[model samples]
Target chain A: MGDNLISVNNVSVNFDYQENFISKKQKIHAVNNINIKIKKGSFFGLVGESGSGKTTLGRAILGANKISSGNVIFHDDERDYELTNMNKQDLKEYRKKAQLIFQDPYAALSPRMTVRDIIAEPLEVMKITNSRQETDERVRDIAAKCRLNIEHLRRFPHAFSGGQRQRISIARALVSNPKFIVADESVAALDVSIQADILNLLKQLQTELNLTYLFISHDLSVVAHVCDVVAVMYLGHIVEMGPSRELFKNPKHSYTKALLSSIPSIDPEKRSEAIELKGEIPSALNPPPGCVFRTRCPNPGVDCKGGEITMGLTEVEPGHWVDQCCVL
Target chain B: MSHLLEVKNLDVKFDTDEGRITAVENISLTVDQGEVLGIVGESGSGKSVTAKSIMKLNPGNTSYNEDAEIILDNENVLQFTSKQDLKKIRGGKVSMIFQEPMASFAPAIKIGAQMVEQLLIHKNINKDEAKSISINMLKRVGIADAEKRFNQYAFELSGGMRQRAMIAMALSTMPKLLLADEPTTALDVTIQAQVINLIKDIIKEYQMGVIFITHDLGVIAQVADHVAVMYLGSVVEKGPVNEILKNPKHPYTKGLLQALPDINNLDAPLSPIPGNIPSPLDRPTGCVFRTRCPHHNPEGKDGKIEMKLIEVESGHWVDQCGIQCGQNG
Candidate 1:
């Protein structure tokens, strides 16, 4: 944990939703009891389908989402802060150390604002720099690092293409010099060629800035290339966690195996294996007891549904952790 | 055997507020019965525009060139006159599925009612026959509990189920050709695999020609028999799926293939094409891809370079002059 920049300890986020007009409320477990440690300068990936709560967990780390229980601790050489109980002033200061890169470049940036203003906004709101000149200089520095031309900064976002706009978004995220950044599906909206461009830029920046990333995405192939360690989440619980290569090559959990098999191979000769999961993701409001994934698991036994089974991490290999119950 | 659909020298332009912008240019491809032709391109590359041109589904501002010809079953669809003539060919002979399954359906209507309505309009059948056909089509597309799913609205179904319903509706008419525009793009990977398999199985069973448009090369590799790689409204490379994927001739095609992160080779570094795609309004002269093409040389002895499509092998074509220009002094 010494090298871990951010450590999440048993975090869970629950939301209350009205069942009907009848005054009945139900709890939606968006992010169940989870623990993850993002190492310094490492690209950690959190992957799942639409309702898997990856986004919520990412937001919780940034102090944007409410944490119903558990703690999220941010460690740095200068200072350490527990985000779950931070006051408003401390949270504001914590914001300068953490930021988010949004998913849709089209909707994320303001159409009327120029690229320079968009990037400078974080510095201005955070009061990191005093004078406008200081903010302008910082913006230019980060903009060049992100490969945005100085002349293009004066132009509005509409003038830039999807890839260029994403670069601007990256510049905006980096303006405050954040240590931990959550890039939530940042390249999901871009084309494949452009997606590579953004992905390479992110990897380069991670090393250059000595930054840590909690990259949340649903695309497995993209995650396989950019991330060092990967965690697969289902509903809200992480069923498998290991190095990217090891997990992708030999997945221990059945859910991880199904996900790896679902990726359409580029080689036309190789057809996907017959391991398709049946039915859609279950509703988080009424998730199945015991194992959250047991309803869709190909092999299920009486023990799988005995009671509310909490998964204890079992070290399958060095630095690899999987749900203990997953092993038949 | 005659091709089910043939598009020759097609060019589409739109009268925009700024000026006339060409959406698609000189694109040509053919889809034989039971064959799937993939049109792969990035956004604004005019892949969807080309698909829409088959059914003339573009807006009123769209203008097609005089020489453009879309021959469907030996009849030129561009020459379609009267609403009835277009109607008979549009949804009856050729049906389309869009990227957003939820938006494609009406919120107020039930899934079964919508399918039945489409059937009644296309086929001169009674209400009872239409209902039965609707239920059967839903079940054929792998929608479990078709009877129950039929009564539910589009909102009630999940993303995967909605896409299945959309497919079932599109195939209910028994069309000769199917135009699928990113039908599985909105689905999760697991669901996308399921939908892709369903589409392939249906194409085999019905023997219907398909024009599958997507930006995902992996999906194209799994489904398309022939691949047409488009860039900035032009087909940069066209060949059989194996030839295009394995032995790509064009520089743009090579860049695109290399850009994708291969699952088998996770450690390989991705080489994205440098520079952004030139906007439609600011399209470069000569080759449309020369602005960002790795094999583009602006300092030619004569002047700017000129590119032409050259047949590299049987049923394979690439831009020849672009490569020569980059290498020549």
Candidate 2:
């Protein structure tokens, strides 16, 4: 794992919540003991349904969410820093190095701000550049790379379409010259045609800048297309993780298999098998004691519910890790 | 195979503070009994507006062209004047389910009460019969403990359950036409699959004509018999689902298909349509898709290109420019 840029070791994020004044407080295990390593310059996909802890994990890595346990290590050619225990100054530096692109382009950009100002915001906030001229140059360079017209920079965000606004957001994310980016549902809100455009732009930028991306989304096909490595999360645990091709072609976990089968096929003649998971996802507040997915697992047995199951990754194939309990 | 609904030369416009915006223009489609017409388009493509116009569900500021005809069972629905007459057509002849199920339900009211109220308005059934029918519909939609869930409010149920309740309520009246506007878009993948299967089964059992609108071509391919590809308030192509998916004729259709990341072919490069869709207020002159079309003649020097729908194959119609552009390529 020497080439790995970020390594998450047994990381967990817990949130305390109360129903009302009368009810006792409860700890919601948003992301339970998870471990994964993302290689440098690779597009790693984090996929799950809502409440699967994918977003929480992404936030945890970006230092937006407090990690209750374990560590997230960020490595580069210059230095290495543990994100979970970074000092104030180090955290600020990490902020410059790692950035985020939001989901809704309509809401992500400030309506009143011109496209130039929106893209230049990170530089101004972080004081990464010395003068306005430098910031303007950086913004223009990234905007051009993101395929935004130079003249459109003077107009407000409201004048742009969804895909253009997304490009503006991408330009903003890229202006900081970050080494890693967490694109949380970045293309989910755009039209399918526009989604492909943004995805192609991201891929192109990744190659040009040598950047790593944590692409988080609920859409499996989109992830299967762009990502080099794919990790499937259920509840708070990663049930399956492997190279994109191997994972989609030959999934080991039952949950992963079920999710793949659930996608409505584009081919009219090829109907997916009836492998629907029953019941809604269990609440994170008081998740089932044992395997979090046991309730919805189609092939669960007594061992699945006997005791609390900690995630243990077993490499079924080279570089493909699946939960041990799922295999056993 | 009789026609259940026919929308001819429909044009919908909204009077906003800025100006009048045309949402659906010169659009025509027909649905036969037990047939599913899948309308696929992006967010602002007017698919929802087309579905809503069948029942005149738009706000008071909406205006329709005088020649616009929405005939339901051979009766023009747009000409309905009396509130009672429109009500008879709305939930009686046609029913709709929206993307957000929670917004569709009355929050303060119990699910059972809301469903019962809809039944009472549409049918001449007694309270006991309505209650039984509501519970049975809930059970049919695969909700567990239908009685308990029926008594609960919309907030009490989960997302999937609420959507199921919405479908149950929509289908309870047994309308001749069902307009589902991205009903499963908000659902999880597995849950969406379940709901899609449920809708397919219900369509079969009731023999209801359904106009399913969604942004997902995959979902349309699975359930729709015929499909209409919309762009900038116009249907660029209309054909059988299999034909459209397997061999798309329109450049936009081909671009859309090529853009999709196929799970089976992970290494294939996606070819996205270049340039953003023009804002509705700034629609182009000739073909709406010509702005981003790969086949557009950059140096043709023609003043304006007139595009018309031409049948490329039996049961498959594509815009003239789309075919011309493809041939040039």
Candidate 3:
């Protein structure tokens, strides 16, 4: 069927320190050798705790971060575009096909701008519309699709609640008719009830617009339900990758198991049995040499403690990959 | 047994530029020594306001109802109007850890200096003793290299470490009560678990009453002995944590439970409350949640049920409006 829309091949994003007199020459490898293919219309989830480089990877996919190495290929019906080496002209065309929905609704939308202007900024900036009338028409169409009342178009961001503000951001992201959407912790700031509403809206929009979502979040439960496939990141490395059901039902990596168990369950009794990871996430600047999770991994393999090992994925089962250092 | 802190008819209203907004309405809850009373609610549900009222921490333009009373150790806390008395009440007898640690700490001050200052306020200890105790408190909260960290500022520490330092400062006084207002909400899940576990252990060790305010039921189930589910200022339902999770009665509580994404049961559909939380200015007449209540009854006078929390089961409470109008068992 060959319907893979975006394939990330050995994508490594490194942030090099400025070589000033006082500064030492060091590099922060934000994303290290990541490879994953997002299907045409599937909800692909990239989940990890903070500082796990999940956000960096998501931004790398969007061409926001300067890639140190590797290439990202975007497949359309007509041609294959190398996202990493895209020229200005290509990037402009690529911008229409890919969009990003930010996490903080309060910070993302400008208080000075009206809801309509916020949604129309992308169209005007990208020169996707010929006239102001065309931009207004497209903004109104997307706002209605996002369930925003027509009267809300005139109001500023401060007048709307978190959920409504998020709806506005979603409408803004979708105004350009992007096929690939990267919603990076879009509902993390929302209340539980409101989070569900936003999530439902996202799902509905995905189907109606025929969109492929790269949902990045630290909350595993939310991703487990919303995504078809899940990739668990740990310190710039993907420790586990599999179908959502299979990953939750049978996690292969030690880090994945610890993460899965650490989620506070609604059932009060489940708290006691949680496998508590001993310490906080290690500094991303200097992660453990052999296994990135060795410092906090509940169960470490023989070579995991201090020895250097190749950071590679092993197909533990069909369509299920685990980090090579996993004790199993 | 006497409660460490008791809030009765606690109604808080803020006189804003637009209009007077009712923050908390006719609220009542008690926290016994060594007990954790969780107040769970969304942004505008007034859980933070209730927590703030305990320490008289609400800012200017805020007014407590005339009949409102908070009893601490058999003494009324509201009467302590003088700075002399409020100074002792603020951190000496009751300490609070906030959601954002960086905001609470003075950027100019060192972590050790802040903790030692708090310790000195509550206890008549020498500077050296206070510093040692501050270091010990930092160590107790699981911060590595406590001695080094003690000299550092809030900005120097990582998020989890900063939160730990905040907890260290809060506990340095050995206060009779602790008010943790969404202390772990901003942290990652793993760090959140660690903090929750730390709180659980400290709760056992200190036996001091704690008022844990958060919006997540999952966190409440972990750290709380009893939970009060607030909907737009009023506690719609409350009870023992087990009873609240296993057999929630109020439609709002049920809706919240349904909204939670069950990691184990990922297949189940999420039924979030139908409508957005009504703005405080346009809040419903009597049960504030009636606008979004799935089991709303039109029979109540002007579509408002008498606001009352009734004990439907042992240690479990459901708002009278919910019970009377609820169509489901």
Question: Whose lDDT is greatest here?
Answer: 2
Model 1 per-residue lDDT tens digits across residues B1-329: 77889999899999999998988888888999999999998899999999998898999999999998999999999999789889988889999999999999999999999999889888999999998998999999999899999999999999999999999999999999999999999999989988998999999999999999999999998999999999888888898999999988677788888999998998789989888887788777677776676653654223354545678789887766545642432
Q: TM-score of the B chain in model 2?
A: 0.96
Compose the digit string of candidate 3's lDDT tens values, residues B1-329: 77888899999999998899988899999999999999898888999889888889999899998888999988788888999888888998899999998899999998888888878777988999999998899999999999999999999998888998899889988999999999999898878888998999998999999999998889998889999999889998989999998988788888888998989898898777888888787768877777787763775425556679999988888888887765453
Give the distance in Å from residue A202's predicted Cα in candidate 3 to where it truly belongs. Answer: 1.0
List where candidate 2 sits over 4 angstroms from the true fold. Answer: A305-310, B297-307
Evaluate all candidate structures by whole-model CA lDDT and list the values in order: 0.89, 0.90, 0.89
Residues B2-35, candidate 2: write the lDDT tens digits. Answer: 4889989898999898788888888889999999
Give the poorly placed runs of model 1, Cα more than 4 Å off. A305-309, B296-308, B322-329
Better of 1 and 2 by DockQ: 1
CAPRI tier of model 2:
medium
Tens-place lDDT digits, model 1, residues A66-153: 9999999999877889987789898998998999999999999999898989999999988899999999999999999999989999
Q: Tell me the spans in candidate 3 whose CA falls farther than 4 Å from its real position.
A: A18-21
- For model 2, chain A alone compared with the true chain A gives a TM-score of 0.97
Interface C-alpha root-mean-square deviation, candidates in order: 0.9, 1.1, 1.1
Question: By TM-score, is 1 or 3 better?
Answer: 3
How do the residues A1-328 of candidate 2 rate in per-residue lDDT, one tens digit apiece? 5799999999999999999989999999999999999999999999999999999999999999999999999997788989877899999899999999999999998888899999998999999999989988998899999988899999999988898899999899989999999999999988888898899999999999999999999999999999999999988889899999899999999899999999999999977575889998999988887677888888886788664565577999999999887888
